[model samples]
Target: MTDEAELLQRLWNREKNSIDEAIQIYTPYLSTVLYYMAGNSLPKEDIEEIVADVFIVLWKNAGRIDSVRFTIFL
Candidate 1:
């Protein structure tokens, strides 16, 4: 498997470091996307809270999410 695919699996399994890995890899990207999704109308603090909420949900649901090939997280 690709390194990222393995990392994703680790996330699904709740490996201790997996969320940190995700933060390292995905936070910047997701934050940028969410900024655009919010039309840049929200304040930075609100955006940050939204981002945290999203990750929390991902953490909660990771194990139950169906993946075609470990290619989907949201």
Candidate 2:
């Protein structure tokens, strides 16, 4: 299976490490996107807060997430 697939599966199973893996994999991408979307107005700390909120939402909804629809979470 693809790495993302495996990660999603682990997330669905509530594996603690899966969240770490996800943050490692996605944080840079999300941070960049958020930074750009924020138009450089928000502080780094605000961007970090938004990113954390995103991960929290992802974790809360992991069980209902479709493995094939992983991109939806992002």
Candidate 3:
């Protein structure tokens, strides 16, 4: 399986550092998406907050997640 798949598994297991890895990988993508979704009008802090909340949600729901499903969900 792909590295991202492994990461998703780790997230499901609540392995330490998995969320950090996920944040590193997805934060930029999330930020850019949020920017465009908000018409690029949101302040940087607001974008950051939204991105953080996304990760937190992922962590909370990781047990039911898989990379394929998550990529589609994202």
Candidate 4:
């Protein structure tokens, strides 16, 4: 499997760094999504909070998530 695939598997298994890797790889895209979703009305602090919430959701749901699937889902 590819590195990202391995990372995804690790994330599914609850490995600590897996979420970090995912965040590093996907934050820019996720930020853009959050920004757009908020209609650009959010301040920097609010945007940061929303991004944190996104990562928290990802961590909470990691077992059921496929990173590749989420790449598309995002």
Q: Against the unseen true structure, what C-alpha lDDT does each candidate score? A: 0.78, 0.91, 0.87, 0.82
| Candidate 3 lDDT trough over 10 residues, lowest sum | 65-74
Worst lDDT run of 10 residues, candidate 4, spans 65-74
Write down the lDDT that model 4 would get: 0.82
> Can you tell me which runs of candidate 3 are displaced by over 4 Å?
67-74
Tens-digit lDDT string for candidate 2 (1-22)? 7778889999999999999999
- Using TM-score, give the best candidate's number: 2
lDDT of candidate model 1 versus the reference? 0.78
- RMSD in angstroms, candidate 1? 2.6
Candidate 4 on 1-74: residue-level lDDT in tens? 66767877888999998899888988888788878888758887888887888889989987996667755543
Candidate number with greatest lDDT:
2
Clashes of each: 0, 0, 0, 0
By TM-score, rank the candidates, best first: 2, 3, 1, 4
- Model 4 steric clash total: 0
TM-score per candidate, chains pooled: 0.79, 0.89, 0.83, 0.73
**lDDT per residue (tens digit) for residues 24-51 in model 3:** 9999999888888997588999999999
Ranking by lDDT: 2, 3, 4, 1
Write candidate 1's Cα lDDT for 1-74 as tens digits.
66777876887888978877877788888889888998869988888888788778888888975555556543
